[model samples]
Target: MTLCLSLLFLFTIQPSHSITTTTAYAADNSLQRVKARGKIVMATSPDYPPYEFQVSKNGKSEVVGMDVDIMKQVAKDLGVKLVVKSMSFSNVLVAVETGKADVAMSGINPTPERRQSVDFSEIYYNGGQSFLINKTDAGKYTSKASLAHKIIGAQTGTLQYNLAKSKIPGAQVKGMDKNTDLVLALKTHKIDALGIETPSAEAYVKNDPDLKMIKSGYSLNKNDTGSAMALKKGSGTLVAAINKSITKIKAKGLPNQYLAQAGKYMKVNTHNTSMFHYWTYFAKGIEYTLLISAISVIFGVLLGTILALMRFSKSKIFHAISIAYVEFVRGTPLMVQVMFVYFGIGIVVNLPALLSGIIAVSLNSGAYVEEIIRGGINSVDKGQTEASASLGLAKTDTMRFVVLPQALKNIWPALGNEFVSLVKESSIVSIIGVTDLIYQLNIVRADTYRGVMPVFVAMIIYFVMTFILTRVLNYFEGRMKHAK
Candidate 1:
């Protein structure tokens, strides 16, 4: 039976691979022909507020700041409708390459490795890498030479990461996916400094009173200019159109205009602000946290049911295997499990990051729920099963009709508890770059350099969501019990 299942899996995977290859090729071809249509889709990361974040007043998306303005002008020059799709920074590159987007217009640098897959337009911005260090330690690292043998943090898959590793050869550089993590690391003194973009570092210094940029300006090599607007290779029409728009924007001085607008909402000067802005940013993060929690809970409940049935089987071998599965899942930490499933399994499987997060949370929650279900099933009186047997009912029907209904009524509260636990556990999925609530809060706190607000907001949001869900579950359990 195992061999047959393995063969079936192999057959299933073969078709999937073929389909993926075909889809990739088709996307590439479609992008090449996009000039025939008058629409250019540009992908940007919306989490980077003041650059490309979504404003949620009336549910209509209005792009703001230098990057958004530049892309819109570029689209107008091409005589195409400009559609901005908000996604994570990493996914932005994939969107461009897959022809889902004509260009990516976040503050993406033109790395040589990226050149192999996509073409870049002229450099729009010229900021280089700099470090944000604790105010007390600011004087310790005066230059790149001084940074040698020190530890620094940077956002992963960035030019800052590359420059930090290369410039300070002896320095220990840790690459984090979220900007908030780098700030947290600095706040906790986990790292000596944070290697960041000049604009981001400037923003951090403005909001964070305890942190300051090193006086000695550290930067990437002059050749490695910070630029934007990445296009897929062979998209000559799109490239030409974007270049013309950039030239026009430069001549008209639109970049400076956009910067001035962005400066209004963001701190332009290096000074602390009232605590009001901090809480506002924190409220923004709550929206994302609730989203991740809700999705994880739904998936976890579905997966738990499957796991319970497997554990309840009559076969001794199945029972032993199920016991091991429960032990393995419960024994490990949720954070480590999230990382393994998202980054580790992601390397082998071709699932989207969000889908991977759901699968991981569900699988983990299912293990505990299995034991809950088994205990509930066992609670059903032995006489009930004996009565079913005397009535000539099969073992499956006896359990399905008599045992399961009673067991479910007893276990309903336990299931609700498991769901509440799953909501909290889902926070770990942020490690794999899902833009869920904790992840969004981290960005807000990092950018604002005020951690208290975002943390508070996240806590309140989680508490409220769990409270509501628990109440609903209790109501259902009561109804079920009364019906019985």
Candidate 2:
């Protein structure tokens, strides 16, 4: 009875303390605290052309756009220095919610689900969504009826994607992760059309002569409602300050000035031309990716073989150390490990990005190869070791002459599979900016405003490489068996 009463008392106190902590945290996240910090971190997606993009002019970063210019005004009004951080659109929301950034202003539209986590400032710019199609198919897509049974692409979780699904009920919609992906899908003939925003589609098609928009008599499910900046929930003070700044910018025509300047680089009108012409710029990216993967695999195999020997060595210290290495490498995620080795180690080692990629991938591959080699070695018969011993051979001689030859024959197939996995795994090195196949794909998507062809090309190249490796390994294995 005493224990039950104690438990009840503890439960009763928990809710009150929790509420007190929540209220205190809410009070702490005020405009005064933000101003005192003297810096406002703004999250944006650099992949969106004419809104936010990364460019180097005379070896300096210049992020120029209507969105950037407006955010700068807001920061000045708040008496805080502006710091822009580039990330994916999805990650922008995460940054705002986590308080990693003061606000997210990369063409964000207020949605119901988003409101649950963060508050949005009043609309800043009015923008409507539209569809871009190949010039040859522009006439055929005059109405919803003409678009029936055709494959259409749109970025995932966007207003355009939702509208396309509801309005074009008969159209097959393929969701992508970015606007560039939608453009690429249309360009490659992977999809007949792409549902995109009007400004973004216009910006993409300016350089392409093969893509066009069907602007005549299309339905607007939602108005090109103005976009707004997102803040953490209940940041009324910050929201009010941003709104006041936006009002001033509108009155001074500063927004228009910024838009006009941005227009110089982007197309302001819809035309029929290929928007994916920039894909040709990423050929060098493909070469870099292949080089990294090939070198990593070669070095990885050599290191793995050495580690495998260590694990099987008679010395207790070598065996223990090898076991620890295998466990450590296999236990961690490849992406985290790659970042740690590249970014973390680069701070101290000052190695080139390509060398860091090779070292990271090789270390990871070596751990798995150790297991594969150990398994192959054990699969060899004990009789071979005993026969070598009877011939007055030393333990090392027995392994080198008798055991390893048979083990290699048995392990050739597994080794080939490991090589294939290593090739695919090399894609992760791109996160540290190693310009692998996926990195090239991203570059092509950004430049051409297209996403499918580069990915398709990458997939084909990986398949061809794996196929050839398999054939070569199989031929070697066959020769080994015939010799025996």
> What TM-score quantifies how close candidate 1 is to the native fold?
0.72
Q: Write the per-residue lDDT of candidate 2 for residues 398-448, one digit (tens) a residue.
A: 888888888888888888888878878888766554556676566545644
Best by TM-score: 1
Candidate 1: segments with Cα more than 4 A from true spot:
1-39, 47-63, 97-100, 215-223, 232-236, 251-253, 267-383, 394-396, 409-414, 426-436, 467-484
Candidate 2, residue 430: lDDT: 67
The Cα local distance difference test for each model comes to 0.69, 0.71
Cα distance off (Å), candidate 1, residue 135: 3.4
On the 0 to 100 scale, the lDDT of residue 213 in model 2 is 69
Can you write out model 1's per-residue Cα lDDT over 1-484, one digit (the tens) per residue?
3235435433432323333434544455433455577787778765554465433224332445568877777767766777776555666776565445678887788888776667788777766667888899766776667878899898788887877887786989998866666788888999988887666676667666798886325544554556767876655555665677787888888877776676564543113433354444445445545666677666665666666777777777877877877888889888656645543444345456577777778778878878888889989999999999999999989988999899989888888888787777777766555666776665555445555666777788788988998899988987997893
> Candidate 2: where is the Cα deviation over 4 Å?
1-25, 28-38, 59-63, 98-100, 143-149, 215-225, 232-237, 266-367, 376-424, 429-437, 448-484
